[model samples]
Target: MPNVVEPKLIAGNANQPLASAITRRMSIHRGVHIDLVDARVERFNDGEIFVEVFENVRGEDMFIIQSTSNPANDNLMELLIMADALRRSSASRVTAVIPYFGYARQDRRTKPRTPITAKLVANMLVESGISRVLTMDLHAAQIQGFFDIPVDNLYASPIFALDIREKFKDRMDEIMVVSPDVGGVARARELAKRINAPLSIVDKRREKPGEVAEMTVIGEVKDKICVMIDDMCDTAGTLCKAAELLLDYGAKEVHAYVTHGVLSGPAVERISNSVLKNLVITDTIAAPEPVKGCEQIRILPTAPLFAQAILNIWNGTSVSSLFETSTMEPIYEGVFRS
Candidate 1:
């Protein structure tokens, strides 16, 4: 934790909207005294990157806001350069604020001769002089352990859980939270416990990235409202396929609640045609225009949560209460549907 006064915020080209939202929530008037350096980035013909940060960050607490999402290599290079610049300018401390950490899904090597890119990303950050990391809803919790420096892995679940509680309160028993895969069973169970509902798991096999075949469900989802939960939604194949299977298995309705929406290539179209009633995602990573325009997709802001976390960490206060609940509360509490 450090002093809040004069905490300088820098941004790479990735997810500037999130940075701006965070700045707004902090009550810092845009562009008065504080500055957001746009690290100019360029890619060479060989696909190499070049970056330059044009601001002095000496003795200042620098928070670099960058989502290593689309064009991940370029954004990552921009962050590394900004950190290098801050360190060379003798900044007191550097905290890399990556809303959506790329390469997180590659936390483990499932096949022979594959590299663990998540650990490599951690090493790169440390080498870039990032003293600490501030990120949300990492693909794997173990990725935090990859860093020797202090890493703060924040959660968007509290925000989503609260919204779910507020939006769908009348039919608690009808709702069954589901994990799209076995890896997300823990996360889905946590949400189910919070909502005081039963949990289900979708047993699926991945033919390759973005292609999955859901075989069957492990719990009783028939005639129950199903809500699929996962850390990130990449191509949406797994989610959409799971939703289809849930429908085939007699699920009344299917909805998805995911932390990071890395909706690439065919994600939006896939979700558009799938059985999902709605897909709720957090504003950890910037949602493209297609995602925003999709009728079935919704974006929830994490600005308040991140702002509160930053304030708590700065004041040496506990953030324990934020992580306690797992259930989705009904939007209205008093009414009951018989």
Candidate 2:
């Protein structure tokens, strides 16, 4: 057998908790002690970001764990700087483990003279000397093609499927998975198939960014509990509107399972007053105080899933097999229960 190369994990300020969790799971799964790099990220008086990697990463396989979420520009710049620092330090390879790839929604141009910011970000990473990228549940699947390096797009469907099975085990017959919009029908349909539930779609019109117009429920949701699925919930406008429409259509209850809970603007307030029973989201983007304090929200940790993917990548194993939800066991039960 060839020698196994252990990866050096580095954490950025984007989401420290998630980075820590992933580090812990990696150490446990490998049965070997692994530590995150003592990297410091701070800003000078003029607000210029500074990054310093304290450990020697020369000839090492390094993975920088950072999610370009809220304060997207700051976190994104931090990632680029860190990658540059690692590359200059003589690291053999640098893999960016961005759990939540921001600016992914702007993958294409809707109007003339517009920019494809997603592709731009990809170019920036490549120019910064990143060898590969590992991200999850991109807003648009085609965004992977924007990257010149090897990109591994992980899915949150298996994670969500496990939770749905456990939560609605007894009432699976009365459950129906719904797509908040036509674009998310494929995602919702996959979840519905996993749990053996009927699928529904919400036909809605979006006049502009962050605004939803008239919405129409296309399937039979009357008397059935609905599970609305989407890639992300930004302002909650579309989610709230779809929930109200579902309730008006005589749906017994509505719940949501979204990958990224951007929850910007009045999202928390809207969810608090919305007709949904619960809004379940992964810890891709750290939940703010309002989202944490909200009684209607539940957070699921994606660290274990990410940890397994990283391990598979390091071992030259198949990463797609990690999507086998039925065969996989949950590792972060305490965090989810809490």
In candidate 2, the residue pairs with backbone N, CA or C atoms under 3 Å apart (3 or more residues apart, or in different chains) clash, namely none
Whole-model alpha-carbon lDDT for candidate 2: 0.90
lDDT of 1 by residue, 185-280 (tens): 888888887778899999888677656643688998899989888999888877888898899899999999999999988999999988899999
Q: Assess the local accuracy of residue 78 in candidate 2 as a C-alpha lDDT between 0 and 100.
A: 94
- Model 1's TM-score against the true structure: 0.88
For residues 90-197, what per-residue lDDT tens digits would candidate 2 score against the true structure? Answer: 999899999899999899999999999999999999999999999989999899899989999988888888887778878889999999889998889888888888
Task: Estimate TM-scores for all models.
Answer: 0.88, 0.96
Misplaced by over 4 Å in model 2 are 1-5, 330-338
Alpha-carbon runs more than 4 Å astray in model 1: 1-4, 28-55, 325-338
Residue 203 in model 1: shift from native, Å? 0.6
Kindly report the root-mean-square deviation of model 1 from the true structure over all alpha carbons. Answer: 4.4
